[model samples]
Target: MSTTAPIRLGTRRSALAQAQSGHVAEALSAIAGRPVELVPIVSEGDTNRASLSEIGGTGIFANLLREALVAGKCDILVHSLKDLPTAMPPELVIAATPARVDARDVVITRDGTPLHELRTGSAIGTGAPRRIAQVRRRAPHAKVVDIRGNVDSRLARVESGDLDAVILAAAGLSRLGSESTLHREELGLAEWPTAPGQGALAVETTVDAPAELLAALAELEDEDTRLAITVERAILAGLDVGCQAPMAAHAVVSGDSVRVRAVVYEPNGEGRIGLDVTESLNRGYIRRNGSGNEANAADGADPMRTARDIGDSAAHRLLEQGAADFLPRE
Candidate 1:
C-alpha cells in the first residue's frame, strides 16, 4: 500500500528469529500481492548473556523491534506471541495472527532419555519458573539448574556434559528444523500446558496503517487459533500476570465450546492451583470461522464474549483455589 517504499517487516537477528520472519515475509508476499522487506534488528536479549528475566524478561526481545516500529523504521513487527507483553500501546496493534504451530514443551536429554527415565539427581538446565516448577513436580529427584541461552546453546549444555538434559519449547526447535535431529520428549499438554500463546506469531502494525493494507494482512488471521490464544492470554490478563509468570494455559475447541486448562505454580514448585473450564461460544453472533456448524449458529452466543468468559471463569476459579499462594514471592 505504500507507494514510496516496500513494506518492512522487523524482527530479531537470531536464527530462530530470521526463520520466523522469513516465514512471515513469504506469507505476506503471497497474501498481499507484494513482497515485504525483512529488517533484522539486534535486540538487547541477543547480546546479553545474563538471565532473561534478570535483564527484563522476554520483553527485552520485543523492545528494539517496537522502537523500530514507533520510529517509522519498519512497517510491521513479527514477534513470538508468548514473548509479547499482556498489554500494548494503543497506537500499535497485532494485525494478524497466522495459524499457530505446535505449542507443547519438550525435554532434550542425552542418549535419548525421556523425562521420567532420567537418572535421579541428574542436572537439568532451564530458567523458566513454569518449566522449573513442572519439572520439579514431575521429576522431583532431578536437579533443576537455571539456564540461559538459545535453543542450540541450551541443547549444547546437554551435549557437552554440563547438564543431563534441558527443557525447551517444541515450537522453537521445530522452527529451526532441529527437532528431528534431537532426542526429544514432549511434555504432556494436560500436565504441562506450556506458556500462554506459545508457538503462535503476532504480526503488529501501526494503528494508522492504510485500511486496505490492514484488511489484506487480517486475511492471514486464523480465527480458531486466535480464539484459542485469546482464551490463554485473557486468563493471563485477568490474573494480571505477564510472560514471566509461573503459569501455563492451553485451549481446545470442540463443538460450540472452548475448554481452557490452566495452572498457577509456586516459585519452588511446592504447590499449584489449576482449573479446566469449558464455555459455550453461542451467546451472540455465532462464530463462522472455526468448527463452523449449523448447530453453532442456532445458539447465537458471542464467541468473543464466550472466550473472555471462559478465561475469566478459569482465573477466578484458580483464585478461589488459592492461586495467590503459588505466586513467586517478591
Candidate 2:
C-alpha cells in the first residue's frame, strides 16, 4: 500500500482523545508503512455537556464517528474503549485495540490530599456514575457533584477551589503528562472494578473496510490485551445495562487464562456488589496474527447468562455478605 492515500482517522475533539488517537495513528503508520490522518469530529457528548444519560449515554461518542465512516468522511474511528457502547452498529466494527494504558482511576486534589483526609462535607466532583458510586462508598460523608470537560478543564475546578477534589481515569492523565497533579490512588479491583473496556483504545472501521485496510490494522492488535477486554466487556454486555448505569469492571490476562473483576453499584455508591471470575481465554478465545479476525467478545457469549453468573456467583456473594447495604437501597 502506498503512503499516498491517507487513512482519515476520526476522533473526538477532546485533548485526551486527540493524544490517544495520535498515538494510535503513529502506531498504525508504523504497522502500515504509510501515513495516517486524523479527522476531529465534535460529538454530541462534546457539544452538549448535559448529563450523559440525557444525551443518550456513552453511545454518543460513537455516533459521529460512525456517521463519518458511513458517509465516507473518515476511513477509521478511534475511541476510548470504555466509552464505546457494549453493543455496536452492524456496519462499524472495532478493528483493533492496541495494548491498554493504566486501567485505574486517580483522585486529583490540591496539595496531594488523600480522599480520606478531606474535610467533612467536602465536595468530590465527577461526571461518571461509576466514580460517583465507588467514591461515595469509600467516603460516604463526602459530597459528590457532577462535573465534566476535558481533563485540564475538570482539574481546573479543583485548582480554582470549585471542587475539593475530582476523580478521573489515571490513563488519560498519564497520557496528557499531568500525573503529577493528582494523587494516584490504586483502588483495588475488588473495591472498585473499572468500567468495561476501560484504559484501552478501540480502532474502528466499516464492516466492509478494504482488505488492505484491515491488514494495516492487524499490526495494532494484541492478543493478551484483546482477551482481557473481551471478558470484561462480555460481562458488561451480559448485564444489559447502558453506559449510564452504575457499573464497574476490570479484566486482566493471567498466565494462560483471563480473570474479570467487576462491580454493580447504586447511583449513590453506598450500596454495591462486585465479583471476580477466572476462565481460560485461550480455550475458546481465538488468537490470530497479522490480518486475521479480531476477537472483541462482541455477543459471542450469552451476556445474560454471564451476567447472572457474575451477579449471582460473584456480585451477589458480596451482597449476601451485607456489602449491598453500604449505599441507599434501590
Candidate 3:
C-alpha cells in the first residue's frame, strides 16, 4: 500500500458513531501521513425499532460494518467496543484500541433530579439490561422504559416530557459534546460497574491488511487501555454471556497492578452477585525490551496472559457464587 493512499474507515451512521469514527480517522491520518475517509454504513440495529435484545442483542450494530470491511468496501472499521461480541470472526482483528475515556453511565434528567430521587412511577429510559437492572435496584418505583434511538433523540424524550430521565454512556455524550447542556449525574463505577469495554473504541481490520497499515495501527495502540479492556472482555467471555445479559465488568490498571470488579444481576434486579479482585503484575519480568517492540516477558510471564488469568479467576468465583442463576436462561 502506498503511504499516501487514502484509508477508508467504515462506521455506523449514528451521530455518536460518526463522531467517534471521525476522531479515529483524524488520528490515523496524522500517524500514517495519509488521508482517512469516513464511510458511513447503516446497521441492522439502526433500521430496527425493536429493543436490542428483542432483535439480536448489541452485536447487530456491528454485523453490517464487519460485512463492509470483509467485502473490501472499507479498509478499516471503528466500533464501540462494548457493542462487539466476545467471539470475533476469524477473518478480522482488533488492530488498535486507543486510550479509553469515562467508563461510567450517566442519568440525564429534565429537572436535574438524582436517579434515586425521581418520583414514584417516573419513567426512566434505557435499553441496556445492565442499566435496567441498576435502575430497578436504585429506584424501584420508577418505570423502566426500553428505548432505542440515537443519543440526541433519547435526550429529546426527556426534554419533551415523555420521559423523566434517560441513562446513557458518559463517553458517548463526551464524544458528541452533548454532555455540556444536559443535567447529568454520573453513576459511580464502584456502585454501578458498567458493561465490559464501555467507553472504549475498537479499530478493526482484516487479518490480511497491509503490513504498513498494521504498523500504523500498532503506533495508535495504548498499552494500558488494551490490557485493561482485555481483562474485562476476558471476564465476559469466561462467563459465557451475550451482550444482552445483565452483567457488568470493569478493570483498572494501576502501577504494577490491576483491579477487576464484576457483577451479575437478575432481570428484575431483585438479586445479584459481585466480586472484586486485584493482582500484582510482575513488572520486572514484563518490561519492554531495548528494541522498542512489544513487551518481552523475560520469565515468560506475559501481562496479557496475566490479565486473562485474572478475568478467568473472577468468572470462576462468580460461578461458585451461583452468578449464572441471576442471568436469563439461554
Please provide TM-scores, in order, for all candidate models, with all chains considered together.
0.91, 0.84, 0.95
lDDT ranking, best first: 3, 1, 2
Off by over 4 Å in 3: 284-297
Global local distance difference test of model 3: 0.90
Give the candidate order by descending TM-score.
Answer: 3, 1, 2
TM-score of 3: 0.95
Model 1 backbone overlap count: 7
Model 3 residue 250 CA deviation (Å) reads 0.5
Q: List the residue pairs that clash in candidate 3.
A: none
For residues 206-315, could you state the per-residue lDDT of candidate 2 as single tens digits? Answer: 88988889988977987667767776666566555566567777777766555677777877665666667675433344455556776554335543344334433544
Residue-wise lDDT of candidate 1 within 86-166, one digit each (tens)?
Answer: 778888999999999999998887788878778899999988878888888888889999888778788888888899989
Where's the lowest-lDDT run of ten residues in candidate 2? 303-312
Write the residue-wise lDDT of candidate 3 on 206-282 in tens digits.
99999999999888898888889989988888888887789999999987798898999988989999988888755
Stretches of candidate 1 exceeding 4 Å from the true structure: 1-4, 53-58, 179-181, 283-301
Candidate 1, TM-score vs. the true structure? 0.91
Query: lDDT of all predictions, in order shown?
Result: 0.83, 0.75, 0.90
**RMSD of each candidate relative to the true structure:** 3.8, 6.2, 3.0
